[model samples]
Target chain A: MTTTSARAAAADVVIRTAGLIKDYRSARRGRTTGHVRALDGLDLEVRRGEVFGFLGPNGAGKSTTIRILLDQLRPTAGYAEVLGATPAAGGPAVRARIGYLPGELAMQGRETAGDLLEHLVRLRGGRGSGRIGPLAERFGLDLTKPIRSLSKGNKQKVGVIQAFLHAPELLILDEPTSGLDPLLQQEFLAMVREATADGATVFMSSHVLSEVEIIAERVAIVREGRIVDLDDVATLRHHAGQQVALRFADPIRADEFAEIPGVEDVEVTDHTVRCLLRGEPDALLKAAAAHHVVRWVAEDRELEDLFLDFYRVPAGELHAEAEEVVVHGR
Target chain B: MAVDTAARTPTPAPADRNGARADGTRLPVARWVLREQRRSLTLWAISLAAITAMYLAFYPSMATDEMEAVMAGLPEALMSGMGWDRIATGSGYLESTIYGLLAPALLLVFGIAAGARLLAGHEEDGSLELEGTAPVSRRQLLLERFAALTFGLFVLCAALGVATLVLAPALGMEVTSGNILAATLGLWLFVLAMATVSFAVGAATGRRALALGVGAGLAVFAYMADTIGEMMAGGDWLSTISPFGWYLGGDPLTQGVDGAGYALLAGLVVVALLAGLLRFERRDLGV
Candidate 1:
């Protein structure tokens, strides 16, 4: 089935964080300093057997949501439920059923990858050999080297393997592909697909919506600690599509094109007219052909334009932040 | 050929056990603790062996006539500090004074250090989160670590007992191997008590240095209280407040496991363990 049908078909809710808010006081000042509102009154849900993409701007509470859901960080207010139990109220029972890759992966320096894998499996109540070796092989992880000696990307590969080794019912990953290259990112997506194929729910948090666009059935866009948009991937795209510019064969007045369906902000400049279109292109084409029989160029709408329109931020300012998002998605 | 077809995947049945997804057994708790303690095992073995070997090497040399005469000529203050006041005078006294008091002190420090490392040190190194999210209760985790430390202490005590048993005959000492075994086991129980106390401190304050500092400071204070209570004569009741005093008064080297002292030490250990569990249950794991 398609993702939309799959979402409608499955009634299971694997994870939900309701009215979650987290506040962190500044470390340097003793007084309740640096009240970092990491998560702010956010509610989220991930249905079973689908990849849910959690997207947000920098410091926009994507990680905060994941952390609180995993019971790694306590919420200043509100509560979270993972796998049908309150996370803050002893979520270990729920945590055991889920696989989590932290946004920041720091492991024991002296331990080799093999040793860490062996130890983590035993800790998570599974046999060490059940999935470690195969997952490592798939990810091209060198399990022989000490963790301290491994590169950042190598360590991230180990983190990925460990999280997926147990084959959890719910996989909660925070920037799980942070250090992976393009090929590995695809492989990781394939792994997620396989897990979802086995009736698992994958909650992938990343700043780049494009990374999510490939695998996510649904995308939740978070901004400044609140979810600004929550919808299926196709709907979000439809709602945020950029305008289509249409040029006429002859000198047409800007006002003439304005009356055409789905055309907005028409400007006629020396036999060329630029306009934004939301719906079908046939109407604009018909309108242009009636004016004259000549050549025209209809510039394709960029996805970035749609992104800016929906986010309400200027394109140039978001470019730097988008680079960081790409870095996070790796 | 044109084809219009689809594959329908069957839906899985709902999980039979509604409240169960992961195993709720406590076995993982023990496994996690044992795996974490692998590094500490080698260090603990070497250190405890060194402390025992240091005593074994030096004790036999003091068994000679000239050395015995020198010990007999030692000042009362030195003897008092060295725990020479309670037991009979002999090479056994020297052995007991060394192993009975100092060895337990060293073991207490070592065992308690290991206990302190279980939480506070793991938290400091950022690996606490690995096990913190495991399907284990905080109390279960704490008890598992204490069990590992207690197991390690038992190994240390057994090794010490065997070493003393083999060496006692060569030294021409008349002490029974049974007495030495009992004394060693008793000393281990006392150190276990100290370890339980340290575990409580570690869980209560999620800071390694602070836990160790507080544990060591508490030991020193107990030693002082025991010393002052003993010297003052009328204030012997004050010794009840310190676990060190309770175990130290047993004089296992010569007296060989007095019932009251054994009871006191056992009570102290049980109380400490229960307090540690309660504290662990109430506190958050990675705080």
Candidate 2:
């Protein structure tokens, strides 16, 4: 049954999930067992050789989806396929082809970072320590120091190195830069780009919009256990409105600013006019030129707020859009 | 230093080079688990052996007629209840005092602690999540941990046996080498069964408190059953159900090996291990 589906899916679609649902049931104590829906009919796809961003707030099911992809957690309903095979059924065969960095990575014992990475490399069936030496150098990690003695950021560097050392076909990183400094985060981003250049697929989840904006070509914004928006990074940025606060030499009416193109939610107080401007600002600039402008300030709307706007949309409408995308193979 | 992007991104290696054998066999996780356990296993073996030797060293002085008289003066029922009925003979004295009592107690503590650390400890610390991401199945992880536990128990028992054997002749204790080996084997099997129960419970539930509670509770119940069963006639059947009963019932120190008793302990280990493996495979990890 899986073979037929695997053959049907283009090899380019490295990750595909159809109505994947994950519900975690609290232990049954008496008759009242609580069920937390971590993933609610989530349908997602990541094409081959691309860095796809998974953006969501905490408890928004980003980690749950990653766990299902890694076969760490089984979905309650629906189908999930990674690299042309069901993760649970493929087991180690599928896992062998993927490099994963968990959100909360913990290392035990007094083993040095070198020792831990060496063991992981061996477990991945890679030969020699040659790969690790280069990764350690790239991350500026001290392999000689014990893991327990390393700071959280250094430990995170170790996690990043191990994930890339195997050079697997797919990389599933959950909050990959949680403890990393900005400089190291950029280095990690470069590493991701390099991996994708070598024909690897990256599915990275993060709440940091700027980071995603910098590297991700496409992103899926998850909210309340569902993917609220999935679109090209450029298109999403184009939809983001700008905050235009204009202070005029003469008193301006709110309706005058509202008459301008691409302007919405206008507020006028005496000589000050503030409004949201979407799309091109050429028309609004010309309209402001008609009035004597004392001070003009236009700030780009935060991507975080744009994400929240998508979440604010009604679930049924978002679900319909998601379904349309799925049906049309967008 | 300038970062080398070209060097960092090497040509992708073949899929097979990552860890797969020609026959599709992989033992990396198992080997890794064993490596992690090495230091702790060594410390446990050495500590157990040293404690066993210390107990053995006191045997020579306690072997006198005066000690025998004191042992004889105790009530027969009391001596039997405490497992000290044969305190006069060197073999009986060592069996009743050390192997029968102290050894099993210490090993039980070791087994329970090690078993909890292997599964629940790793889960709680979140390391198990990273392991799960590798090309290793949950069943493989559980089995490898169980294997490490088994190996550690074997080493600890072997150390105790060697210590007793070396100290027996020098201390004038007339225990046979066969008896020492049998006693060590019996203790190892018994404690291993208990530890397997702990491992199985922890793997199934992922709750360290529950696992420790059940494992320690069963051991205490079994010990008390054996002790109480010896004092009362009607309760003899109770000892039959306890692991301690199986070990003491075999009388390994004096009677050499008890095939039936060893089989019971082995059977318990197998059943508990299977339960753990099944539960671990089915449940979500790092919860």
Fnat per model, in the order given?
A: 0.35, 0.57
Please give, for every candidate in the order listed, the TM-score of chain B alone compared with the true chain B.
Answer: 0.78, 0.90
TM-score of each: 0.76, 0.91
Per-residue lDDT tens digits for candidate 2, residues A1-330, read: 157644654556999998999998866753447888899989898888888999988889999999988887888999999998888888988988888899888886788999888777666655324677877887889999988999999999998888887677899999999999999998898888888888888999998888888889889999878888777787676566788899999888777778886787899999998988877889888988989999989888878777776667677787775554344432
lDDT of 2 at A142: 95
lDDT at position A85, candidate 1 = 76
User: In candidate 1, which residue pairs clash?
Assistant: A26-A33
User: B124-201 in candidate 1: lDDT tens per residue?
Assistant: 676666666656556667777777777877877776677667766665556777677767767777777777677767
**lDDT, residue A160, candidate 1:** 82
Q: How much does candidate 2 score in TM-score?
A: 0.91
List runs of model 2 lying over 4 Å from the truth.
Answer: A1-11, A27-32, A255-262, A280-299, A310-330, B1-26
Cα deviation of B141, candidate 1, in Å? 2.9
Q: Which predicted model would earn the best TM-score?
A: 2
Candidate 2: C-alpha lDDT: 0.83
> Which tens-of-lDDT digit does each residue in B1-287 have in candidate 2?
33545554455456655444332235666666677778877898898889988888888788788998888888888888887777767888887778888888988998998788789878888878777888877887888888888988898889888999999888888878898888888888999999989888999888787788888998999899988988887888988888888887877878899898889999999999998888888887876
- What's the distance in Å from true for residue B88, model 1? 9.2
